[model samples]
Target: MSDAVQSVTIVEVGPRDGFQSVGPFIPTPHKIALIGRLHAAGLRRMETTSFVSPSALPQMADAAEIVAATDRLAGLDAQVLVPTARHAERAFAAGATHLSAVLSVSERHNMGNVRRTPMESVADYAQMVAMMPAGAAMRLNLATAFDCPHVGRIGADAVLALLDPLVAATADVEIALCDTTGRADPAQVRALFAAARDRFPEVRGWAFHGHDTYGLGAANVLAAWDVGIRVFDASVAGLGGCPFAPGATGNVATEDLVWMFDHMGVASGIDLDRLVDAARAVAELPGAQIGGRVRDALAARARKAAA
Candidate 1:
């Protein structure tokens, strides 16, 4: 607990990561409506959609439409995930102002997720930088930076090695270390983030993306926050999991993090009540694999109050 740190940025990924794993096709308008609710709750940054192959992720087939709607949101940093160079190009064409490019540090996972070695993905990212429009931002999501499904645990050296070329290739890009399998412990999370900060002092923006499979999501986030990390990727209602990572569960819930930070006397600039309302709605979606405790607990409390 660094008492000096007071605020954090929560990048809502419910519309993208949360919806991608759902079996039922969420109507495009409904997706946009959820995004609207999130924005109203003061989520200034959001991963609104991904520009992947429509055949691969039919859920994201309407990426352009999602961006078109989110772009109008005042002060919203609407991020679109682009898994490949071709997808990155499509994102730019769709007028995406912020792009998230993900590459798994684990070779096996990278190959399975994007069919490319880590270095090859770095090469593609270099090209993505060349194609970046003026004033637009890019984030490098180092998936499985801490733990991988195929491989048990990834070493800090492996994560640093991958960052070497990635940081060299692009300047001023936010790098997020993702716990794709949600198996990383707090000690591991703290150590990796500390090493990364020391190794790459030039990379100003660092983010933590964690899942709650083993229920360490908020604890790991606290560890990272102790190490000075302020940006985090979380889904509303904990509505996300790596589709490529088996046995992995949903992301740490946005409302859970927000509630934790609020109780800790930290600011996230989000309205917890409104955010819970949004999460409650998302949790009701048919066949959706939702997770998180705060939403249901708060709902129960409200019910008790009414009773």
Candidate 2:
């Protein structure tokens, strides 16, 4: 790895994506507390919430309240996921400094998840990016970039083709390739990142959003890292699953990823002990279950040391 890749940015998506997957609504205060704990655990970048219709995702109905509650976290950059221009407006009003727009690479998955074709979603994203407040930054999350549950395998060329307009529109636009269905392999991950690096070299940053459905999220992360890709999207305690993607699992656990990076001599700037404690707290929430191996291992080690 080059000196330029000395550090990686871990975007904590637990409070939003993680909690959203846990079904039964988590109280607004509990969500706020989780974000607070994550901030205290050395996470600076976080996807705080999404401003989509509550009718669609009742779990995130408290988007406004969640954003308000997290206003006190000094030095934390809170981002909100927006599906449309209207959602972006709502997020801006709710005090979000960063906004992320999503478009799936697979047409079938895009229609299933966002109710639009991939092309239509990209058009919407371009419009949203154009209308974004000059002060706020916009990112595009290319969901199902690897392999789509509904559409089988997706080629790296297809992924780049979808990103063409977004890349041409904005030089610094960041794109996150989401393994929404967690079906991506290390080889696929390597190919996708390499394609992005080679084709869309102007892209500001490349992010990986992997799910543990196949239990290779961290391995894929390692593969991407070898090719100069940094900035990952992880949920605390492995919280998150796509309702549209059957048999999908939660994201790469933030605690588990941090532990992997720390042990591998890679720097993520996250405190594993504090992150594990946060994961335990999240696990105690109603309908929430802890989903990371490192968290469990750390707990066992701590108990043994105490004994």
Candidate 3:
């Protein structure tokens, strides 16, 4: 409702999160092209790839190559999801200046996801944060912070507890509270974000990553935006989900989120037509599942206007 809410930041995660969900591997060139197109579409922060084991996530096997190829692109801040200190070092080795370290708030999900307890992962992440050089950027993505498939309803207090280890370590960090399976409600979203802001004033900014498993991804984004959250993680055409979590879908579609903000007169700084074109291209890639309403509706509207 205010002028400050008029502008926003969109973090393109299709190349990493979406592509990783696909069964077949997307070629490095396809990954690079999509990221390039996303950048041209006005996304500054993009998760290009992950430094996890290729055996585990074959889709991101080209992580090193992607960073090698795209790190120098003008105006694009390339980042990678690092699973450990070694992964973080490797990501930095591949010319990535921005790094994301994930820690799920749900102990059940954390054990299922990374085979570590929440505290164990926190200890590991502390080392990972220490390992990074001062100039390197970081974002702590708290997966299943809202709710987990294995354990439902992670309260705001538990989320703030997970933030304690990293909060004491640095003042230059950002947070991405993820609804890994898209079960997050708007009320809980507003509460958790507000709690995070109050508990960790050291956090530089906040972002939300939500899946559409429950069809609340877009609504959750708006909820977060209402509380002054400007950055978001999205996959073009709703292209991804957790490979480990059954029935999970993609993050809120980048195209749909852009359309939501644009209609509300908010400047997300994203090129809608170009983003839709990129989504269509991503849909053509091997093993991609496309389910974004905006892209399809835009196509229909174009035909209607032409008629």
Instruction: Give the alpha-carbon lDDT of every model.
Output: 0.90, 0.83, 0.85
Q: lDDT tens digits, residues 24-69, model 1?
A: 8999899989999999999999999999989988989999999999
The runs of at least 3 residues in candidate 1 whose Cα sits more than 4 Å from the true structure, single-residue gaps closed, are 1-5, 242-248
Clashing pairs in 1: none
RMSD of each: 1.7, 1.9, 1.7
lDDT of 3: 0.85
**In model 2, which residue pairs have backbone atoms overlapping below 3 Å?**
18-239
Please name the candidate that would achieve the greatest lDDT relative to the true structure: 1
Off by over 4 Å in 3: 242-248
> Which parts of model 2 are misplaced by more than 4 Å?
1-5, 242-248
Q: Per-residue lDDT for 198-221 in model 3, tens only? A: 877768988899887768889999
Give candidate 3's total backbone clashes: 0
